[model samples]
Target chain A: MTDRVIRLQEAPFDYGAECAAFAERAGGAGAVVTFLGLVRNDGGSLTRMEIDHYPGMTEAAIDAIAAEAATRFRLDSLLVLHRTGPMQPGEPIMMVATASRHRAEAFAAAEFLMDYLKSRAPFWKKEHRAEGPIWVAARDADEEALDRWAGGAG
Target chain B: MRVLYFAWVRERIGRPWEDVETTAATPAALADELAAREERYAAAFADRRALRVAVDQRLVDFDAPLEGAREVAFFPPMTGG
Candidate 1:
């Protein structure tokens, strides 16, 4: 079966391995755009970070978003993986790679995927700062990102 | 009537999750039920300004009905990425 999205257990994501996986699927594609999200060290002093999700809801929501991206952008293949639960700094939080016959489609789809993931997915974040763990609120900037994708002058 | 708090909402509420029973048949009613639970719940739900809720796995507004939902979740504006 053709696979477009993959969400898996929290582990050290190997970028080389993941890129190879994309190339394997991109045999007939001319261009590929990949975006990797990592836990920011924020000056290299973070103990750990935690991700909270709504289980079944999170997967379903992500799948739906991928489906939407596939429809909106002409893509040969798409890969998306997100991690949940507790995680330490420098860990791979999520990845999005899109393959297409042209760079425009691949890049647009990758950007679109990240933008949607930021605003639409049901994931929550808590930062483990030196002071203590603090819950971060969703930023208006993310919402504006979506609006820009929708052709608004955000 | 299992109510879940996720992410920062769970933090604000001082828990990872919670389950409660109420006579609420709609999302708004459930919010009311939660708001009336105790000082903590009320404080957690104090400003309904940016709070988002979900019935089952689907995002819905506070006025949405919850007739047959197995889970109801509450959280702040989503920050997923």
Candidate 2:
């Protein structure tokens, strides 16, 4: 069985602490890879970002993705953490960590997790700018990123 | 069944969730039924291409069967990261 840690929270997470803890728990895994996503200010107009999610479905969707990544990569461990609710620009929005015996597997799995989370997870983001709030649209590039993993590109 | 809306859909509908009694056999049928009930529902679901659906908390197509489904959700495409 693959060990997985998944959490969906409204509070901010400490990236450094979470990385250390994940690496420690991964134990004998020779390689660990982590990714962090932060809210960005576009044209310095973004004041804050509001995230909305289906309470139960969001967790289920993320768990399914993490489990798939673990199996595909033969990972020793995996962690996925995402935050919902209002957040300021520059604040950390989410993180994913993967561990495996080889660096290649760890890196690929982390990227895969990110690609799936970006487009598949049941989370919606709205940017509150100086003018008004607007819901962010799903990017076609994200769907293309996910497709690469299926065609042996990743 | 409980019908839930989120993000702009929720904003457009002016509520988060509602219980509906319907004979619709599929999500598309259900959407049509709801759309006929009110202008808000029609507006929220006007563009099918902009919306995504889930049956019983799992994402599914509009043509997905609603048999034994207790919940259905409608929202815009996910923009998570």
Candidate 3:
């Protein structure tokens, strides 16, 4: 398997299986870090999450982000998978995994990957509530988080 | 060129995408042209600062040239994880 993987699919992924597979694919790396995002059910009022993504741009943006992470952290391997379309609250939305020779490298790379993915990726989310569906607004915090990496990473 | 819309932009624009031929030279110019065509587009492009543009599937400034671009997309800031 390639060291870097990026996937966008509507099908839900098996978390346990993905982790085990990623670990194996990472091979001799001494450290592996992972992150997962799930739909948040707001006070039981949230019913679903609808993710819309640009077909060609989604893959391009993720690949570019992953490449940057790998270059900054010297990671041995990385995995990014995100789902689009409707998903129930509590279902997985996206995940990131990084493997590096050291713990710091793996951890930093994972965070960098996440911060960039949050606001830079061409994916928009809409939350379905009892009243109506509202587009999830981009938070200033996420943009700030991404800028924090401008000083550099790893 | 194929002009694409996503998320709320798509909803407000009333369609996912459309083929547009224009003398507009940049994303900003194209937006202005679209906004003039219909009330829905005007509503969508009303707050230009609230939207982002991509030329040929890559993010770029609103003033980026679209000379050779085959596609253009407009949407709000991303909320992905």
Candidate 4:
């Protein structure tokens, strides 16, 4: 079984440090790919952002998604770290890394994880703008991305 | 069952979580029951298309049976990444 590090934490994490640690722990994997998501200022309109996540479901959903990625990609391992609660502009929101024997598989797995996390996970983002706060709407494009994976076309 | 709300659902409902007692057999039915209670609930659940539901941490259809279920969460489509 591949190793999986799925963390749904409120504290901010160092992206560089987490990536370095994940790669090192990949253990002979030929490739490691990482993706990081940051809170954008939205042209100075965003004051900050609040991430409200279901405490129980967040962990359960991410674990299931990571497991699916590992199986489908024949992955060596993966890392999923996401933040919750209030966050300032430019702060790191989340990161996912995938390790595999081939770069293609690693990259594919990372993308798959991100697509699922965008809609499947239980975290909701409320963007606090200077004018007011608004809940970020789920894009139809995101849900559509999962369709490609289900088609087995990668 | 324990009913949970998140995001704008929570904001509209004015609570994050609450204990709810209902004889409704499905999430859709439970929604109707709650919506009948208050205008806030009616507004929150006005459009079922904009919402999602989970039972015991797993996503399920609104018509999914709630027999023996312990937890139900209702929220808008997730914007997580």
Q: Return the top candidate by DockQ.
A: 4
Compare the candidates by lDDT and give the number of the best one.
Answer: 2
Tens digits of lDDT, candidate 4, B1-81: 999999999999999999999888999999999899999999999999999999998999999999999999999999999
Q: What is candidate 1's lDDT per residue for A51-151, written digit by digit as tens?
A: 77778888888887788778878888999888888888888888989999899989998888888888778887888888888777888888888876675
Q: Which stretches in model 3 have alpha-carbon errors above 4 Å? A: A151-154
Ranking of candidates on lDDT, top first = 2, 4, 3, 1
Question: Scored by CA lDDT, what does every candidate get?
Answer: 0.80, 0.92, 0.91, 0.92
| Poorest 10 consecutive residues by lDDT, candidate 1 chain A | A145-154
Model 2, residue B76: C-alpha shift (Å): 0.5
Q: Kindly report which residue pairs in candidate 3 clash with one another.
A: none
> Residue A29's C-alpha lDDT in candidate 1?
88
Please say which candidate is ahead in DockQ: 1 or 4: 4
Report iRMS (Å) of candidate 4: 2.8
lDDT score of residue A56 within candidate 4 = 77
RMSD (CA, angstroms), candidate 2: 2.0
Q: What is the DockQ of candidate 2?
A: 0.68
TM-scores, all models, native as reference: 0.90, 0.96, 0.96, 0.97
Chain B of candidate 1 vs. true chain B, TM: 0.86
The whole-model C-alpha lDDT of candidate 4 against the native structure comes to 0.92
